[model samples]
Target: MARIQLNNIQKRWGAIWGVRDVNLDIADEEFVVFLGPSGCGKTTTMRMIAGLEEPSEGEIVMDSEVMNEIDARDRDVAMVFQGYALYPNMTIYENIRFPLRMRGVPKEQHDTLIKRAAGLVELTDYLDRKPSALSGGQRQRAALARAIVRQPHVFLMDEPLSNLDAKLRQHMRVQIKHIQRELKITTVYVTHDQIEAMTLADRIVIMDKGAIQQIGTPDEIYNDPANTFVANFIGAPPMNLIAGVMEQGTFTAPGVRVDGLPAKHDGKVTLGVRPEDCTVTADGGHLSGSVYGVEPTGDMTYLTIKVGDKLIEVKAHRDYRADLNSDASVGFDPKRIYIFDTASGQRLR
Candidate 1:
């Protein structure tokens, strides 16, 4: 519903920075996610956009209009919070209708708007119940209904699903994505969970140390991480990084060695490969290690191999089994390996 822009946005407290030199363009009706660890400034950036926090520098713009001087309520942006920010004393219907009433919508239109919002979020049955009467998922749905009733130009959600159980989170993720597509509103979601970012975002903005690390589709960022931080951060098992030395067209590390590699950069480097890319063998392969641990997760098994000072995670098939402390070897798929500069943590071709 609106195109959002953040230009060189920075926020600081005296000497410490919260968000630094952030520049991003959110397309009209696009679903964008701000992803990072706690204290990484993703929440701060979203807060700046919602007018909850004032930026120490730069501008926040919506639909070609600068929003720095605008009040949060006047900006026509609805925020759904992680804690569900609902009035505990009010019924679900009243909570959903709160926004409409605050914005001075006619009393007659409130019922229709509230009903539509509740129905969209599957909260119509619970509308007569107070928030305390509902489960966490139901409470979250009511919160979403509250924001939806406003029909704001921009939808800002800060980890709205974090409070739910794993199963409930999955269910709500689908609902949130469906609702956004149906409404076609420009939504900016913030979360520390990469799975949420990868699944829900049209494009993901990854931040670390109060700076944007990389911005791309889930596939791009996963397949081609800009740095080691992103490589390790994106995956559930995360990419395995082994310290090595690169010279000429070959790379060498403890228990691992590869040759005929692309000749781009040389010297000490770190090799990155996703857990799925590694195949575990009993004896010998590209690398050798000892089985540190084995975890069976129903559908698949996770093999933790200890190679000298490094631990490599291997996502093996479900039936795969290995004894702890047993000898193991790992074959790295040459085509899938990533090389990063050891000092800078930046990718090297």
Candidate 2:
């Protein structure tokens, strides 16, 4: 296992910068995930670490050794792509054994290592089947087995589960987490899927437009986002942001009001509240609006309220009322509120 550090790393495509001044310190045996939307420089950052693409500037240090000039083959890092990247004609056992063979392991040892990896990935039964004969999930498991058989110091995965169906993705998530924990190899997985990052990562690095936005544990990023972008990006249904001014210890909006906001913020501010934070009240609430829509998710119901030009989503245990066009007052606790600077989108406190 190894620790990875990227110092002032940069990647440029002619005049356009792909990834700029990116610095991250990943500890040994830590499972760190790089998460962001597409074209957000996540893949560029990973490629630089793998030496698949050299940085325009900066250094990559692994296990305390600077690897700026190291070739990918010499870096002792293995990468699993979105596609399984297995040889179609090669049987699963052969595919798993290929890396060991290339590394010049003895033929006798290949069986033991390959069998162990296949067993770990639950592919012992399908070891003789070719990639074309396997299901998508099975093929992915084979790919994972191949990566692990080599026992590289650092494992870099670029959306390795993107090709699977929803159900398979969910199952593979648990499997991947189990394997990562069992092996204790340093891993950096890049994905745009927030659920994947939240479930699998020890810590998450959120990026956008080639810049680092925030890096923290899943709870830290979800509960206390560093800025407006992180706040909006990390949550499902996102956070509701209301533009208003803080005056007289309250936040005044077009057709809504949040009480006791001035204690934490002043001047122009954006008030943030998650769907789960807002409540429907019959009376004595902070704001009132008509229900725009209702979404049911079996365990919880999400209600979107239309207040002038703004729409706020509230999460409730169940569908509160039978009618859809009802008006309701919604209230938010002051402690659950988030205040941000309108101009800079930075957190207030």
Candidate 3:
């Protein structure tokens, strides 16, 4: 049972702060993802937990013991990196058995452990082949098998699927999820891909500029974001944010007006609405604009509309058709609208 806790963790390099004041409690066997863009300190925080880098402040705890001063090898954590760090000279069987050999596990049990780990990743048939002989996906699977052979208390995976192509990445995502569930190990996955975080994590930690933006389940993060940054970052096309003024619960912009909003302090505010929440309507619509572009993705269509200077995307059925430069009216549920402070970018209740 591995329960990991990061308490007010901070990492600094001279005057630069890589990670700041991060506090999180990860339950035993829980899968948590550290998600953000590059240079946001997600990887730094994971490094601290793995003992690859020491925290400038606060504590790293596992179960009930402090691990800040412990060496990485003694932490019993296995890491899978974005690069498939397999030994090109060694066969897959030897690569998977390396951890067992390093840990000095009994020679009699090495064969069983190696085969079990390889089988979990479907690499049993490729055990005799060297890393150079396998494809990119197969090589990554070997790396995973190496980590699994340890059966450690925690798994630290840093963008393990980022190197794969889209389809392989999707395939590996499913495989990784299944393998984690079978192992039941406490896992900390770091990635900049929102789709991976949304699909695989039990909870996601969104971070930016060396600090956490929000921590919640995918549903909560997607349905109820904490700020404009989160609203803009998590979605595919991202949420449409229109700069406007709110007076007496009515929001008005250059080409948009939405009423029936929560009656709070009214002033300059940014209104946010997701593309999927918007639909093309002929009458009683919230906003109207000229169609800028239409994109079809086999299963659905994305229509881009120009509202004054801002462009808004609306998700439509695959069979939906629209003409470019044509006038269009789009409607959205007022209850689903998100309001934020213009100055601070914080959510307005």
Candidates 1 and 2 compared by lDDT, better number: 1
Query: Model 1, which residues run further than 4 Å from truth?
Result: none
Q: Model 2 TM-score? A: 0.97
What local lDDT does model 1 show for residue 109?
93
lDDT agreement of model 1 with the native: 0.93
Which candidate has the top score in lDDT?
3
lDDT of 1 by residue, 1-349 (tens): 9999999999999999999999999999999999999999999999999999999999999999999988887888999999999999999999998889899999999999999999998888888998899999999999999998978999999999999999999999999999999999999999998989999999999999899999999998899999999999999899999989988878889888878788777899999999999997665688898899999999999999998888889999899998889889888898999999999999999
lDDT-based ranking: 3, 1, 2
Q: What pairs collide in candidate 2?
A: none
Instruction: Please identify model 3 stretches exceeding 4 Å from their true place.
Output: none
Report, for every candidate in turn, its global Cα lDDT versus the true structure: 0.93, 0.90, 0.93
The list of candidate 2 runs beyond 4 A from truth reads 262-264
lDDT of 3 by residue, 96-207 (tens): 9888988989999999999999989998999999999999999999999999897999999999999999999999999999999999999999999999999999999999
In the range 1-349, model 2's lDDT, one tens digit per residue, is: 8989999999998999999899999999999999999999999999999999999999999988999999998888888889889998899999998888888888989999999999998999999998999999999999999999978999999999999999999999999999999999999999999999999999999999999999999999999988898989888889999888987668888867877655747789988988888888886677787888888888889888888888888887685652566777888977888988899999988
CA lDDT, candidate 1, residue 23: 100
